[model samples]
Target chain A: MKKYKILANEIIEFIIEKNLKRGYKLPKVNEFQQTFGYGKSTVLQALTLLDQQGIIYKVQGSGVFVRRNPGDLKEYVALTENLGFYSNNQNVKTRVLKLEELRLPPKWAVEKGLPASPCYSVKRIRIKEDGPFVIEHSYYSQQSVPYLSREIVEGSIFSYIRQALGKDIRFSEKYMHVVKLTDEQAEFLQLEENDPALEIKEVFSLSDGQIFDVSRLVYNYKNSKFFSQSSDEILS
Target chain B: MKKYKILANEIIEFIIEKNLKRGYKLPKVNEFQQTFGYGKSTVLQALTLLDQQGIIYKVQGSGVFVRRNPGDLKEYVALTENLGFYSNNQNVKTRVLKLEELRLPPKWAVEKGLPASPCYSVKRIRIKEDGPFVIEHSYYSQQSVPYLSREIVEGSIFSYIRQALGKDIRFSEKYMHVVKLTDEQAEFLQLEENDPALEIKEVFSLSDGQIFDVSRLVYNYKNSKFFSQSSDEILS
Candidate 1:
């Protein structure tokens, strides 16, 4: 991640950690610079990025203030971010419905750039405060991932990939469409059959441009608002 | 618009005008340079931008090939773009449901940054080949737009704002969420009253960062797939 993005994420953590509310005044730019030990320009860039994301707003003469609380922001899925659900919803828990290793990858997985060799097929539901809002079916290339454990699936996979494996996802090809909920999906999401659900398909590649994971995420009909910028800059 | 974005839009138009198909071979870099009279770097940048948008793909040794037919792309709305619907679906037609000049704008308009003085309230349905798929309720700032006619509302408002008024939309703050269709919206979109509909709300600004337009668009549940890049780069 870039320095500005790192600083911006740190500031979000700070806001949430301090239980900041809307209109709550933040530290001065110089205070941020002194605390974070970043250059003045980098700190300003981080603030500007946050302002653009509607997280914090700057008044002409006044200092920066929170526009919305982080808890309120948990419902919005950042379209460009691959940080996983746990990053946004700290209270989110995972239920692994299916996890298996396969020698012959499925055709859909192969089509999404998964090697036709050993791979893992996983199905999981992300349980938030309300209920299970997201059902994620993922296929990971074993050659790239090497292994998978139930314990790891219960936590943030992206964070594990970045911190433990030292591999970072650089970019993704994503498509978002609406689909009527199936009986099975409805049962899982606690929605009526044929309810409209937002389905997002993503193919993730590592920084070295190697395809590693392909995931199809189906969100509950309600609480499925996603956010992305018209600019190509990554939100985080 | 930037030179590369302009070229990219032109390339998309050329692909559509020529009725290009998936796997179709596009002109070489030198051919584009000669035809468009742009520097090689600018031309390459445009192609790279398109490649990132999944419009075209390049093989190591082989030349560029169309990844998908432009006609097949109409269903995906570019989230980062403020170009309006007509740019994507040229065959789309508009039916004016309501067009009026208002002294005191609605609360929604004011909340979205509309001036309280005078503005234009526009309600229209966009009819595509399939059926009426989008209901647009827009509020335009009269101070910035000056004037609007039913004829302009029947066509592309954004294009008029750019070409006729000499003002271009620079950026927008957009939110996408799902809503249960109301009786009126369902009748206009030909969906059930409680069917899921995708709603997009955007506040558009001019090049000088002045807000000029605020629009709430409701799309038919069947054809509301929008596209956007996670990267900060604008996908033309």
Candidate 2:
């Protein structure tokens, strides 16, 4: 990481540690220089980076102030990562609606990279404190996963895949569509049919480049927010 | 880039070059190995990557076949990238609705990183051959932009900023929300009031870390699809 980015992260930690609220004045640049022992330019760059990210703001001739508290904003689902319900939601629980072992993987599953052999198909509703936030229909290749149980499904399957099975998920490809909820989906999310929602189809590959999982996630339109940040490398 | 990724890109180019149609059979793995002079494993890896991305599908005994032709699927607005309508739409044109200079920037604009001095505010409706696709409300810091014109706004402002002003846009941060369109927004998008849409708020920074632009975009609910892809590094 760049020196300025390291300092920016430290500043964020300090803000969280001090429980700074919005509009609370921060220490001056020289004051931070004395504390962190960084040069003036480095400190300024760090602050500028933070300001650009909406973490803090500067007033002319005045010192910096907090724009928002850390964690005050709603968490956004990073589009590039695998779906992990545990990381974002508090007091979350899973209700497994269906878990079946298929003798011959369905045509859709095969097209999604599941082999023609046996596999596990799961339908789950992820509930937060307020209500069901997502409905997921997932297919796991038995060739790679080899095992599935209701107890594991209720918890974190990704964790089980990593810790218990010793598999590392390397990357994911996702396609998203803006869709209206069907009656069954609406009933699952406790929303009305025809309500707009986001449907994400995802494929997961393991470290060895083995495609082992495919999932379709439908998020509750009212409760979900997504965020993305891109650098020059991503520009067309 | 890795050798396999390079090969995958080459394969994509080959697909386009051959004008491969849906269900058209591609050259066998050996043929690709002969053409690219890569090892069998490398060729397989490239094919696997393409399969994971929904570009091709392999039959058990039959050779690989094209699942969809190049550009067959509707283009998805990559969540991590800026809103570049030109890249995705055909015959896209911009209709400048409002453009003016503000002596004292709005409070919301200031909060979004525009300096308190003079700036340009613009409202534009982007139309495609079908109809209006997006409505954008944007604020550009006069300190960075320096000047603006209706002719420029009717074209690509970002292109003008890069090509004419020689200012490099280094990065952007985006926040997305699922929203119901207001009556005014509905009229602009030619949709009914309360229609679901994606609202994206974005802040763009220059190479030197100056936040020069902030924009709010409302995408037509019926015509928009967004995509995101992440690696292990982006996992929470």
Which candidate has the top score in TM-score? 1
In candidate 2 the C-alpha lDDT for residue A166 amounts to 91
**Per-candidate local distance difference test:** 0.76, 0.76
Q: What is the DockQ of each candidate?
A: 0.30, 0.30
- Expressed as tens digits, the lDDT of each residue in A96-171 for candidate 1 is 9998887763775556555445888889999888888899998888878898899998788887788889876655
Per-residue lDDT of model 2, residues B21-111, tens digit only: 6558889999999999999999999887676444666666877876545464446666645546565565778999999997764676567
Scoring model 1 with DockQ, what do you get?
Answer: 0.30
TM-score of each: 0.77, 0.72
Clashing residue pairs in candidate 1 are: A230-B80, A231-B232, A232-B231, A232-B232, A232-B233, A233-B231, A233-B232, A233-B233, B77-B227
Residue A121 in model 2: shift from native, Å? 1.5
lDDT of residue B3 for candidate 1: 95
Give the lDDT of residue B138 in candidate 2: 89
